[model samples]
Target: MKFTKILAAIVTTAALFSTSVASHADALTDRAKSGKPIRIGFAHEIPWAYPGDKNEPLGFANAIAVGVLKSMGYTNIEPVVTDWGGLIPGLQADRFDIITGGMYITGKRCKNVAFAEPMGKFGNAFIVKKGNPLGIHTYKDIKDKDATMVTVAGYVNVDEALKEGVPENKIMQVPSNTEMLAAVRAGRADAGAGTYFDARNLSESAPNEIEPTDPASLPEWTNNWVAIAFKKEDQDFLKAYNAAQAKYLGTPEMLEAVGKFQYTKAQLPGDAKADWICANR
Candidate 1:
């Protein structure tokens, strides 16, 4: 009788634990449906995710995230800002529920977090001194000229540069786009490497000091897509998010949300899916 009672207690506890685990697995989905606030993590990168004049979250990625969440009835959103390097760690630490910083969906990052479908595509470009004094039009130019390039720390541009044969010592990692521009303007580096839109935005802000390489000159392999990130365990939330995204993406609403940030229909990812990008990239 004693043995049977012990076995029964153990089974009951095991079943309770399994039920709790299942409930937790779908907690984010349930929370969203209940109108609970979802935290969005973003890096302070222009045209991706940044603070607007009113200090509200604004950027192409943020707009997409907000639009999708709103469509899913998740109206309450809390923005958590961090440096680029901190985005993944912050999400893992539960500091935010989603990463909406226009992060690239790389094969390496795929192992860390689940990504929603890509929102858009972009290519690399260089921010060079006015007139591109050193003729630094491409990653190959940077390598051939032995030019020092600066990019944001933790950005995929850093890896792209290295992959293109730019020496590790020739590439400098900074904390933000502003710093990258400063490095180039101050002559600390010959060029600033970033997304085509980022380089264009920075160059336009300081037209006399820098100019962006024609994005078309970039090799096709340098092209990449950006997506929002969610914790790997939040499969339920990611599923609902992707479903909403399918309905929202490529719609006029999506275009209007990102149009102000210089994104156009040309930038849409089309048939690009997160799983394919992860597997292939």
Candidate 2:
């Protein structure tokens, strides 16, 4: 428990430290005119951002990032593989012009950096074992039935479960998504909560031992709008990205090329978790 608190504290401190750095008031325009290749930092989220063999980054977001930038006339875009926690800070430090991960457009996040129009939306939900030992059907099922939930450490999923009345102590926040899935399969946890697409991939990875629960039964007000993160003041990059995104939205050819890289269960639009990311969220 102490370790958990310490890790959370470190994350908070990292966020604060980054905020302090931005307070120096560096003009976002000084380096806005780089004619050089846009160096994009991307954290690998398999199936979403494919971490291919040798951990080469790939996937919808990776493809979209490269595709969008290339379409916007940047031919020398580079990919920087980073852990989930480090992706944002590296961007803040100017290590990359953009971190091509699927970032949600949330009010809290917008304060740090600008997010382009959502690249895609995702619904948040939990996955339970077949038969659902605790009959875990809803957020309330977790609360009233004394079920323990699993989540990636420091990820928003843990706090979302807490808001549903599941105690913080009842939630397990491991360091990575794989560990969270293992906990559920090994019976160390009753359920694992995450993005619906990711849950689908986990289930397909081990069909007999795991199964996804109905999203409708989970908390109602949850959605994730993934966008690329940029330096808060990088209005130029934001404009460039938005222009490219606008050009591709609703186009058949763009979607076809990008869809080829997604996981098997995620090939269809709004698969499994319907409505994708709720427009209202």
Candidate 3:
């Protein structure tokens, strides 16, 4: 009868484990459907997620997230602003449920967090003096002229530059686009690097101060799409978030919402799977 009791205990334990797993899954779904606000991390990139005049979050990512979540029965969404470099860490630390910055879904980043889906795909553009004094249009151009290329810290452009043979000394990593532009404007760096959309916005915002050159096609870089990042373990949350994203991303409403940002159809990502991007890389 001792053996019989031990077998019964094992069965009971297995049943309890199964119930616990289901409870956690139900909790995640219920918590999301609850009216409680979900926090999303944002950085100060224009047209992505940046603080407005009243320090309120406003940008493409923020708007998209707010719209989708509200329709998903969520009434509140909070934007947790942080530096670009801090986005992933903040999410991992539970400072936010997800990061809504236009962070690219590179293979390197996939190891750290689970990505929902592609939000937008874009190429890189360079910011230079109004008249293109140094003719710095590409990483190769910067390398050829031995000019300094300023990029935001944690941006992929730095890797592209280094791979293109831009010397370490010729690259300055700043904390934000503001600092990169400042370095270029003050003649501290020969040029600034960022996404094409960012370059266009910067040029329009400061017309006389800088001009955005046509995007330079870096051989080592492919067109990368950005996605919302969540902790790797948040499978239930990630799945729900992707469902919400599917309802809005690449839709006509999506275009209208982000139109003011000047993104083009060519820059929009097709329904390509993120897993493919991660695996091929």
Best-matching candidate per TM-score:
1
TM-score of 2: 0.78
Q: In terms of TM-score, how similar is model 3 to the real structure?
A: 0.87
- Ranking, TM-score, top scorer first: 1, 3, 2
- What are the lDDT figures for the candidates, one per model? 0.90, 0.69, 0.81
- lDDT by residue for model 3 (75-106), tens: 66677889999998898788888788888887
Worst lDDT 10-window in candidate 3 = 26-35
RMSD of 2: 14.5
The estimated TM-scores of all candidates read 0.90, 0.78, 0.87
Report the C-alpha lDDT of model 1 over 35-142, residue by residue, as the tens digit.
778999998888889987766889989999999999987789989899999999999998889999999999989999999999888887889999988998888899
Q: Compute the lDDT of residue 12 as modeled in candidate 1.
A: 100
Clashes of each: 0, 2, 0
Candidate 1 lDDT: 0.90
lDDT of 2 by residue, 147-251 (tens): 888987545676577677898788888766788889999999998888777677788788988888776665556656677777877776577678887786546
Clashing pairs in 2: 50-58, 103-227
